[model samples]
Target: MSDVEIICDKSFSDVDSEILDRFVEFQQAIIDKDEAKLDEILTEKYELVHMSGKRQTKQEFISEIMDGTLNYYKSEIIDPTILWDDKERATLVADVALTAKVYGINGKWTLDTTVDFEKVDGKWYFTKWDN
Candidate 1:
């Protein structure tokens, strides 16, 4: 696999490292097609919103990944910003340029993505991915 360029804002702190790491792992899981890992990292109510406003539940997204309906070759995450809504809830916003095949279409697509996370039991889980 080729390298993925990830650029983040300078505002992140040591307290934010766990969230950042989990977010990166989530991206890598998509490229690696690691369904089990994705399942582990996502909340039970996780939803993935596409650029067109279509929403897919966690299971639906993982199914597509497993079947090759959604294939991620690589990604470059640019200017990621983190915003904490509370001590346990946070949002990560970024522009992600993705090289992939989606629903039989293949190309590099740049998307503005906002991912929400919630910390529970001292662990973070992805709650929503809006693009």
Candidate 2:
């Protein structure tokens, strides 16, 4: 028999206020290029569908952001709407823009975006990002 190990990468659970609060914090993290700060908000098991067409684990996502490989000089979330399905999961829709930047990219498409998130232990984490 072969020993099999499974890695858990489940989406976040359903929660509301915490989820939105974390979303705000996530925006801050992006601006600060903080890795550990972002990781602290995630569950041991998490998933990220990046806007740049990549799927990565929680660590991968934070590392890339903090490493300057994927730089986000200026960004903002406007007209945000949060939907909570439970105490561990929710979704958000918002309009964003880039106020400034250096070498990395800034600004999303002119259109709006929808992001789904999950909450655990009163912390919000992004589970999905789709345009």
Candidate 3:
């Protein structure tokens, strides 16, 4: 993620910064197609809800990206906002511009996304992505 540019609209607290770092890493994993890193970052029950209302389990989503059904070339996170439900749960909302190919369609799209994270045993893991 050293090559990626992440622009923040406002200053963040220490907790928020940590979450943002994890979020950036997750985006980097997708671009690099790093399955191991993805697994480490995402929870076991991770799910992704697509813009088309399609739902995919963790494995299914990873498989699609691996098989090129969903290909991610680049990503840029802009002005992310984090809302904490409690000390253990939070959601990050942002407009992510992604250059990719999805289900045969290729383009750069700005997606309004909400990513859920939960703290377990002092570590934050992504639980879901609602796009």
- Clashing residue pairs in candidate 3 (N, C-alpha, C atoms within 3 angstroms): none
Query: For candidate 2, lDDT tens digit of each residue in 44-103?
Result: 566666455567777776777766666654555566667667756677776655443423
Candidate 1 lDDT score at position 85: 99
Candidate scoring better on TM-score of 2 and 3: 3
- Of the candidates shown, which would achieve the greatest TM-score relative to the real structure? 3
TM-score of each: 0.93, 0.66, 0.94
After superposition, candidate 1 runs with Cα above 4 Å error: 1-3, 9-11
Ranking by lDDT: 3, 1, 2
What TM-score does candidate 3 get on C-alpha atoms?
0.94
**How do the residues 6-78 of candidate 3 rate in per-residue lDDT, one tens digit apiece?**
7776899999988998998988888888899988988989999999999999999998988889888888889
Model 1, span 32-118: residue lDDT tens: 999899999998899999998889999999999999999998888888888899999999888999999999999999999899999
Steric clash pairs (candidate 1): none
Task: Report the poorest 10 consecutive residues by lDDT, candidate 3.
Answer: 1-10
Residue 126 in candidate 3 has what lDDT? 95
